[model samples]
Target: MAWLLLIVGGMFEVGFTTALRFVDNFRNLPWTLAFFGSVTISMGLLEYAARSIPMGTAYAVWGGIGAVGTVLVGMIFFDEPSTLIRVLLILTIVAAIAGLKLFA
Candidate 1:
């Protein structure tokens, strides 16, 4: 299923970003490799899913997934702020993603 691939790809987007934080400007060999590997799979799946999904919708959804996921990762693992407005905005992104999926 294209949707499955897209969701999984989005998760890989999270993986790549998390790994990126640990890369230390590419000096950390393991994290660097993990970043590249995850990104490769993420993009590959996005590329494939785009064959069926509309390009604009697919790209927007992909970015939304990445943005929301990265922000959550930051707050959870990096002790980033979890202010009310920030969380509300993140929920908006989620709503938008859901809207796109439902309307697509």
Candidate 2:
């Protein structure tokens, strides 16, 4: 359950970042609200999950999910470059996240 929350938190991390891009330095009210709400939920969930999961492992996984999700969002929605090397590297991060879970 903690792991599930951690994953959800990581997804919210992605949401917050995406919202950030639309905020126009905080001038956009709706997206600014989204950014803050997403951040609040993300942090709350991370804090809760950290109570059970090892801090280092939880943090690494959370960060990995955020990074990978954000990159994919950029690629799929924003037309960011998706070079072969970039994707291969992202897969390694996914593998590392899985490895942490497996060995934890």
lDDT of 1 at 62: 86
Candidate 1 lDDT by residue in tens digits, 16-48: 999999999999999999999999999999999
**What tens digits encode model 2's per-residue C-alpha lDDT throughout 1-104?**
99999999999999999999999989999999999999999999999999999999999999999999999999999999999999999999999999998997
Candidate 2 whole-model C-alpha lDDT, 0 to 1: 0.97
TM-score of each: 0.96, 0.98
Residue pairs in candidate 1 whose N, alpha carbon or C atoms collide under 3 angstroms: none
Whole-model lDDT values for every prediction: 0.94, 0.97
Cα error, residue 52 of model 2, in Å, equals 0.2
lDDT of 2 at 79: 100
TM-score of 2: 0.98
lDDT of 1: 0.94
